[model samples]
Structure formats: structure tokens, C-alpha cells
Target: MAQTADDAKYLWQKKLDNGHIRIGFNDVAHQEIGEISFAKFPDNLTEVKLGDVILSIEGAKAVSEVHTPVAGKVAKVNVALKDHPEYLESSDEDKNWVVELF
Candidate 1:
């Protein structure tokens, strides 16, 4: 089947000041997923390969798994999302980002 617009944008990637790669769903995806109610992320420092599942989230619409587009070690994750998943709903890319890959 053809991919939907949201499916085409599986993630938005940005390079941090420290050179880590930050990734998250873009506005298109956020609109599709809605308010995030829950999130599961792999532990920090975990080795991830391209296409590996790095995140799982429950949102207003449906549960989804996010795969990595680049391979690297898990440098950091927005731990704040653990308590306040609504951060994912924000337009602020910094706050919406899920993980930083080394």
C-alpha cells in the first residue's frame, strides 16, 4: 500500500550543538498522533542500528513505534517525557524530540 503523508514523515532529525542527532515526529506526525499519553524508550547508551525500533508511544489516536533512520549509541533521551508526555504535542522541536543519538 502507498504510505500516507504522516507515514512518509516518520521522523524529523536535527543536529544538536554537541553533534548528537535528535529525532522525533514532525508536525505532520504530531497532528496524526495527537496528545501523547505514554512513551517507551530504550535505555541510554543502548546501541541502535538503522531501522531499529527506538521508541513506542501511545497517543490520542493510536499506539505507534518509531524506528531509527540512523545508527548510533543512545546518547540521551528527553526524560521529561516520562512524566509529561504532552511535551510531545508541543511545536517546540527541542521539547518534542525523543532521543539524542551519539
Candidate 2:
């Protein structure tokens, strides 16, 4: 596991067994965004570069944009969030992950 941001407030990276990379948010990010109300993600984006906004999470406190940490093709998204947005606050770090980049 790897983390960006001095505070580790949001971003994390992990290399999978297949040598692909995955990036997502940590628990602290959810705290910063407060209670999650909604989330939006691009439907047809198969590739992304570092700093690309892959997702946007809206919460009671504010709307937070989730960026890619490295250039890669998107492998999957946590579709569960579409119905259970509250998981951003209630789920563990692994479960709260918004997307998987590979």
C-alpha cells in the first residue's frame, strides 16, 4: 500500500498481483467530506491520467473530487455507492474505496 498527501487524508495506492495499480480514498477522506449524500463518476472513461477527477462525492459538509494518483485505465468502480452512498462514512477503508485503477 502507498499513500499520497502529507496528511493521508484521501489518496491511497496498491499494486495488485497482476501488476496493475489501484487507487482510492482512505477513511479520513470520508470524515473530511462529512456524511455522504451522493456520488458521481464518468461512465465511459476507460483511461485517466494523474490528477484527473475520476469521481466527485457530495456530502453534508462539501463536495469532494477524487483524483487519480497515477496514469492508468480504470478497471472498475464501486457501484454499491450508487445506492448506499452512506458507505463512504460507515464502511472500512477497503469497502469505501470509490474506484479501482489498473
Candidate 3:
């Protein structure tokens, strides 16, 4: 079944820009994980040595870890998303990226 924007929880896509990869969890993650209550991460902009636990998100049901898909420097974390966790559950692709690497 095709998921219309309204029917989907989140979406993610890759971009080729200076070796940076953006990752976001779609509405499905939000719906499955429930409200996000907490987040854990290494020290700011810590070098992620490939396949490391970069961060973790705590939802109402469980805490999930966000891994470093590839070895790179953690460029930016979406503080906005951290403040407004519900956005993770309802945003379209245009507004749903959780992290960016450089």
C-alpha cells in the first residue's frame, strides 16, 4: 500500500553533499516508539569512529540507539527536534531529518 503523507510517520533520503549523510526517522518510528522523552549522545561533535553508538533516543515504550551509519564527524544535532519531539512523528520528508554528518 502506498503511504500518503498523512498516513506516514517519517521519511528519509540520502544526499551527496561533502560526504555528509542526513538521517531521519519517519512517522513509522514515531508511531512505534511513542513520545520521545530523552536523548543521549557522546560529547559534543565527538568523532564517530565508524559503527559507533552516536546517540540514543528514549521513547515512551523503549530507548533506541542511533548509530553512525558511516565513520565521520558528527556535524550537527537537531536541537529543534529535541525540543519538539512530536515533529519526528508527523513531519514530511522536508522536515524530518534528525542528524547530519560531515
The candidate scoring highest on TM-score is: 1
lDDT of 2 by residue, 1-102 (tens): 212233245767778788777666667776676788887787786899877777777878776677776778888878887887887676475667766777
Which residue pairs come into collision in candidate 2?
none
TM-score of each prediction: 0.84, 0.80, 0.67
| Candidate 1 segments exceeding 4 Å error | 1-8, 43-45
For residues 12-79, write the lDDT of model 3, one tens digit per residue: 54664667777677667777778877655556655776556655667786666666556666677766
Per-residue lDDT of 29 in model 2? 74
lDDT of 3 at 23: 65
Clashes of each: 0, 0, 4
Candidate 3 positional error at 54, Å: 2.5
Would you list the clashing residue pairs of candidate 3? 9-26, 9-27, 10-26, 10-27
For candidate 1, lDDT tens digit of each residue in 23-93? 87778777888888997776553888887777778888778777788899888888888888888888898
For model 1, what is the error of residue 47's alpha carbon versus the real structure, in angstroms, after optimal superposition? 1.3
Candidate 1 vs candidate 2, TM-score winner: 1
TM-score of 1: 0.84
> How well does model 3 score by local distance difference test?
0.61
Q: Is candidate 2 or candidate 3 better by TM-score?
A: 2
